[model samples]
Target chain A: MGGPDYAELCQLYARYAAALDAARWDEWPEFFVEDCLYKLIPRENHERGFPLATLMFESKGMLQDRVYGIRETLFHDPYYQRHVIGAPLIHAATAERITCEANYAVLRTKLSELPTVFSLGRYIDEVVVTDGGLKFASKLVVYDNELIANSIIYPI
Target chain B: MDGAEAVFPDEMTWPAGDVGRVPFLAYTNPEFHKAELERFFYRDHWCYVGLEAEIPEPGDFIRTAVGERSVIVVRDDEGAINVVENVCAHRGVQFCRERHGNRLDQGFTCPYHQWKYTLQGDLRGVPFLRGLKRDGQVQGGMPPDFKTSDHGLNKLKVATRGGVIFASFDPDVESLEDFLGPEMLGYFDRLFDGRMLKILGYNRQRIPGNWKLMQENIKDPYHPGLLHTWFVTFGLWRADNKSELKMDAHHRHAAMISTRGQAAAAAPAEVTQVSSFKASMQLNDARFLDIVPEPWWKGPTAVMMTLFPSVILQQQVNSVSTRHIQPRGHGAFDFVWTHFGFEDDDEAMTQRRLRQANLFGPAGFVSADDGEVIELSQMGFEQKPFHRTVAELGGRDAADSDHMITETLIRGMYGYWRKVMGL
Candidate 1:
């Protein structure tokens, strides 16, 4: 099955990672369609078929609310996050949608501390070609680690 | 400063038995941590294990910890739940590695040596104990005095109440009812209420701070309005809200009860003055604040209970959970959140519980700040071991309060800590 060009899909993931790593949270929802699902869940629950997720946004509106929270509501020590994401492996594709998965490692560095491996996960995503551009229809971040650090300040 | 050294030793000091001031050494000293584990966790205290819903069928088990020591909570053939140490009695190995599984009828077996035990942790089979025959003669047989019953796994005293479970290392410890006392037991029953529990899911985070800090965080109502923007802006928790602080007779267990007030367009000067409060903040998806009150809540919209050394029972609006504080050492602890719902809840109620849960857990909108502050607080305590923290929000004494503006619960906890630790 063929949808968008492989290079275009690669560019979409690259830009998404770049935006997240830079903490450009406002640009996050733009990567997804107006109606989308974004979930960051531990693999433990995911494998058990449990619905609980570390962070779940059922709609793009919910994603925007989280952005508002990070920008205006939440109080946390400022830190920098870097994402090292692997190439996306497309599983299936149609004229309207594409299914793929990619591995990711997020490294975080606090102002006074050294860098640490904050999270290790893989993204299972559904991409669709909208009039604007290729956007995520659904993205499920399944983290391999059972225990998270003190908190997940930003989206993985 | 004149008689500071005389009244207090160099290792640790408190101001004449006053619970208001807590020493930094309490969170930094390794030796003191061991004493706390012995006095507060291992003896006389019933630590929260897991919900009965976790192991519904025979042979179902979940591997957990009782103050850092691995243990298994399983269901036996008789349908009675048992709490057994995960250690192999022979080689002293923690045999169970999986966090959860079904033991079925086979029970547990140590890998190093095929020493088998029943679901109740009784020694059932011992390979080669009777010895195998070699040609014409038997070799390496156990002595006639060997008895499997004498070599069974260490069994913990177990208690079950309204689907919740607790276990203790001390057999003579008080019963679960007496341990919680009347006031605390009423609050416990409000949440548990004999209703069947449905396990939603779990969230585990390693907080780099003392385990007691997690308890103190829930106990101290002063920080919720000041530190959590989501709580303050959304009116989930406020300084002026109708609230009350209640503690057990021993002051080791506590409950913070609060009823959410009307959301006013113009907030009071006191609340608006807080750094975390945002008057104009709003959720794009208003469903997060779509709180549907349950009959169990009675009047209060939220009730956070700290059950001494082990767990925190939470009933925050539509979301209810158990926060288990498993200490690793003086410096760190594992905070496990078990978000559950009543078995009678409908699909809509379950979804509401799940959505409202966004306000908690490690990455929660309100709770993430808690984990961060506890970590930073531990750092401060470690940096200056001689320094002490001031917990004189409402007053210098620890007592039940009628408002949410006090640190009385923290003081009360340290009051119990001082008595138990003898420091």
Candidate 2:
């Protein structure tokens, strides 16, 4: 429904990442379609065929659950994050779907620790465009950092 | 148990070639372990630090602890990986405090007092005057105690092969290839294939066991059938006939790999287990399955090898990565696992890989069994209360192994261990 091309579909991505980086969670889920798949995982376990990930969600509700978990439930350092998204390149495209690949890095400044890189990865995204602009059918974050110093939380 | 040198039967004495069961002290004692860290591990031995793929750009950095010493391995301005001690030259405050980054213009700066250094660990500048800057004579200036040149980060010997960075506390350590050797390195290169990597994901776990326990677990294939009922009961792995073979190296490093096949039928009655969970029947559709649709009975399906002391090489189908471990205490360890794929992996392929990626970490059905079992072993071994545990399982001689159940590889490790620990 929007520009009906690659850059438009990708602009929606950079916007979504920027908003989430800004803690605009209310606007975060709007970028995803009804059945969205998202997983934030480290590289070590994945090589050994291990599926335990930092964040694993199969739908928009799961993404919302993660947001809720951070806000209401689990304990983490009260911090702020800003995601810097690189230019996205289209990997593939179909009549209804567009696949975009972009490099992403997040800087999270916590209470005591110095502002450090929270997460860095390649965003392998599949989006479907409808009347509601572009929606994420799935987003897989493949983290570049092998040694995760402490626990990793929040979306990147 | 306290400072009492381990006493045992002549057979119990280790690094000596023998099939007799060795004492458990070799596995449990802090003195013995300290020796291993200092001699074999820290001295003239290669340790996997981080992946070479991590520092992709000039000035990219990752801070990690090799042994207890914090190390900052950063890609310098020229895009070459430089492994330096994380401890700064001036104060003890660590530079590159965060996990990973790119210090483009300004080099690494200390968090505490603002002492700055380049990626190569040179003392670039100081905050104020020589001392605290009184009447042109500052108090507490650069210490006469140690000069900046005299206090460059304690540099360790580092080398790389297969896109994995390895470092040793000892500069005299053998080159990476010589340390790994042709037989072992050849098998390792299969996973490395030398293509640009696309990271899949990562996971971490803390197991209640010595770091060596993890090394032994990956090298000992017997545990797969005996321990991983989650995979077996779910029809994940049927024992293949003599498919699992053990290859031992001089440094106590070993590779345990299983060729694809069904176990020699009628080998053991307990090998097969009945399933209790209904969902077990559903194929998880994880990435390992994505590579080969049918059961693997001909080619090698899984390869698990250790890079000595602290890291593991895991190859499951087309997904490859490393599992690095840091021993927290005599009975504690922090485990890290990384996932990677060729850059050419398609979006659909990447998704299938993520879904099928389940086996060896904390949540892995196959590897989750390990944490429970590792603790049980630790508890059982500790029951001897500073006494030694027995490691000879399949044979009596060190390095003598057959049919996957042998702890001889462990004894071979102890041999190298004693040589390093100078026991």
Candidate 3:
């Protein structure tokens, strides 16, 4: 991958994060593949073979439903989030589709300048170069920090 | 049974039959609640500490507070569980200080002096004690008059039902069966029913309200039709006007019990939240609107029995819970909610329960409203200790009368309060 494709992919990843951390949440669905699978399963349940999840979203529709559910059904103090995504590491690339990974550290400052390292996770992404160049075909975020401050109200 | 309907003494007359005119000081006075903790919680009744599932591995220990003291619940190498004081026996330092962990280094080491003890809290080793001894005449090193037993962690009376473990400072409390009371024990037996619990997660809230009031809020059906109409608007539960709320002889506890009704039961009040909720969500899943997860729970006969003085055994439609409301004082309560599913429940069913979980806690739709209202109520009760609130929801007289969604049970709890405090 050269400058044009590589730079374009990084920008897409950045937008995906921005739409999330910036609370431009509705824009999140566009970042995912229509048939995307997203999940935030706890390690405790994983080890115990429990099927329950802190969050379990099967499709982009379910993920959309999550955002809608949080907005209407949940009551949380208003807060802001900012995501900083690093350059992408292209794992395997083809002309039409590219598999890449990037490290992300999201700094969430709620109501003040005292920003907290909300979550640090590595994003494993599969990108497709379609008419919409370098859109995420699949993004599986493996969050390093357990015990989120509250919950992931929006996609990362 | 209909404690709330009991008449309270007015300026006109004296009331009778263990029903009227109980003082509200128990909610505001730290002194009375403390004595009650000693007499009931510490002396003769067991307190719920933590579930057994919390510490399954050898050397696993978790710190929990029961009433006012910090207690360490540990699982030994032999898989035997013990409830001991969290305080270090030697200098009274906290032994297992962290919330939870595996202390496999030949027992627990106090962070202060590095003194070590077994999971059973026996003196495993005292750091540098033998080396500090002069000429094998261990004079002041081990306190020549000191018996190791004297320094071991003080233990509390403990019992378990299902995976739930309960302990008490009370030396002569009745058995777990008798302690829970027949009505409560029967409901608990049905809820837990000897099933191993798979903890989904824990959510904690430090509500600024009297712990007793927090329990009353849960048992009060009076609020649901008005405050939590969101659930009814979504068609989640139908509160039976025929249903009754009651409490035991000791009014320190409460039960919001609603009997399962046939589909043919007469209509009571029109569901309240129909217009308030976003009509869109009600349009999406009408099943979410009506179908409940727990088969035993028909039309959502959710009963939250606050086991007095503290633990609340909840039987919701999908999520079964045991919330240990550790009262910080007369003013605040630290609530630790443990959500569960039967170990035998299938993956799909478990998922359904977790999804249904959306309706609770602070993030939860149904729970967030109560959470806010309770905190406000706590704030209002102040500056007006003499001014009072009424518990009369379903009219007067006993025998569990009138509307099911009444403050009848709350009144019963206060009656029990007067008995315990001899007020």
Candidate 4:
């Protein structure tokens, strides 16, 4: 295939954000390939090569497990999260994969209070073109701020 | 006086030294928080600062807090570790601002006035001592009566046990091993078995609750099966498992240990059959839940050990971590979690620990509910400060237990808290 369309890849990012913002958690794993990695790590850990991540999923199956657990087992305060995704900065594009970076801010509204910026981070993604268009082979959500307020129950 | 009479009449008070009865005011009162910082933190307790592995080389330093005072733990030229106040003696400004760094040849230089100090916290030089600038221009300087030797950074008593460092403001405080007690020391040594630690990462969480609540959470072994349904629903923890609450002789330190028994593996099916335990979930990658047993640890599968004032050594399933509780105020505290692994861990072993990380950090499936519950408990105090929380699960006394369903450890922690705070 020819070089993946940058506009189409940006649209894929928009779709992923909307799914999470809508709390359509069941659809989250569909954004990634069958064998993929998704990790939400602090920038300090990312820079220092620390092995731990706040949220680490080595495969799409693990991502599905997280969604299932959060929906079924875990109990957290009732809150709604809205993810604002910025434009993607495409680094390299090929027939098989594409590397891109995008900035994001998550605003959470709980108990009808004002929406607060819960977390701000940049998404470093490795995208692949499959039968379903662009799917993330690897996505690293590196949060800029280290101090997490209360807990991060929902995905960022 | 009637039984309902106020304990202290005017000021806030504890009702008859009952470990089960914890007044909500203790968590919300500002006066109590101040007293705790003075009596429990500064005067009496040995607070865990950092790991010796963090500053292995000379001049390597990491800044931390002992209650509210900023402290710096550095390695001197001769490889001895020193703990000193981060405040500059000249102007009382914080000198070492970074969280951690290497100052190999050059010693700590005050960022504000260019005052210099050796790694051992001795006053080395002042930039313009005799009012002579770098260009040899004479200007105003310190008064002649000011002695440079007496103005060195204030040092604290430092101690290391199994590579973990602890510092105390009071030099006369008990030795590290004695403070931890023999029982706790054994478990502490088991956790930190002299293996070089590789910092996996950190999950720093700011909870809107009293610091004691965090400690109590670790001490209360009864809450896991009830509060965190993920543990029960996923067969990771069971109420009928072989678990116990072990306290030190003074009841100041405690460890809640849970071993995975054969019966524990079957508990999920039995629990899920009941309406309360039924939850719609299944792990696609169940390998993450597998516990690759460490050869050294012959104890329980899970252990949450509390070191009195502010440190917690935890081995939840396969994840090993230390939590440093920094009290922000009466109503809030920060849980600085340092996740670690043995330096000799193979690739698969490291990945297993990293994969299991989802089980217990700030955003962890099992740990996420704790922050919420603690915050909710803190919020409850705003409406009812005079109300008391009942910790009468296993009677009022604080002692060791053979069962997981007990509040003995929580009471033991508060018992220690009451003694240290002189309540």
Q: Per-prediction TM-score, please? A: 0.97, 0.68, 0.75, 0.95
**Higher-ranked by lDDT: 1 or 4:** 1
Cα lDDT, all candidates: 0.89, 0.65, 0.65, 0.85
Error of 2 at B255 (Å): 1.2
In candidate 3, how many Å is residue A91 off?
A: 9.2
On DockQ, the leading prediction is: 4
In angstroms, the error of model 4 at B244 is: 1.7
Question: B1-423 in candidate 3: lDDT tens per residue?
Answer: 333432332322224543433344445656767876676567666788988877878888888877878998988889888888888887998766577788766677788877777888787667655446678655445555656666777788778887888988766777988777776676666676776777776655566677777777776777775665545544455565345565555545556666444433333446343344543343333322233546545443667777876688877566667778787777877777667787788876676676666556544556755665665566556544433566666654334433565666676766665556555
Model 1, range A1-156, lDDT digits (tens) per residue? 667988989999999989999899999999999789998888988998777887888888999999988887778888999999899999999988999999999999999899999999899999999998899999999998779988987888
Leading candidate by lDDT:
1
What does the lDDT read for residue B102 in candidate 1? 90
Which one wins on TM-score?
1
Interface DockQ of candidate 4: 0.82
State the TM-score, rounded to 2 decimals, of chain A in model 1.
0.97
lDDT of 1 at B163: 96
Candidate 1 clashing pairs? none
- Model 4 chain A: lowest-lDDT 10 consecutive positions: A66-75
Tens digits of per-residue lDDT for model 3 on A9-125? 878976777677667767776777666655444334444454444454445665565566556644444667778888889898877788878888888775745888877777777
The lowest-lDDT stretch of 10 consecutive residues in candidate 3 chain B is B5-14
Give the Å error, residue B101, model 4: 1.0
Error of 3 at A144 (Å): 10
Compute fnat per model. 0.71, 0.09, 0.06, 0.87
Residue-wise lDDT of candidate 4 within A34-114, one digit each (tens)?
899999998888987886899999888988888877887677888999889999998888898999999999999998678
lDDT per residue for candidate 2 within B1-423, as digits (tens), equals: 343653432233444453234456655677666766666556777767788777788888777767656788888887777788887766676656677778757788888877777777677777652677678765886555645566566676778776778888877776788888777887777777676666555576666677778877776665676566544543445554344455545746677665545422332344453233222233322233445422221367666777677788886554456888877766767787777766677776665555455444554445655765676677667655444556657665565343665666666776666565555
Taking chain A of candidate 2, what TM-score results? Answer: 0.87
DockQ of each: 0.78, 0.07, 0.15, 0.82
B1-423 per-residue lDDT for model 1 (tens digits): 533443334678576779988988888889999999998889989999999998999989999888988899999888999999999999999999999889986899999898999999999989889888989788886787999999999999999999998999999999999999999999999999999999888999999999989999999898887788677787676678888999999999999999988865547767656865667767778888888988888889999999999999999899899999899999999999999998899999998998888888988999998999999999888777777899999998989999988999999999889988887
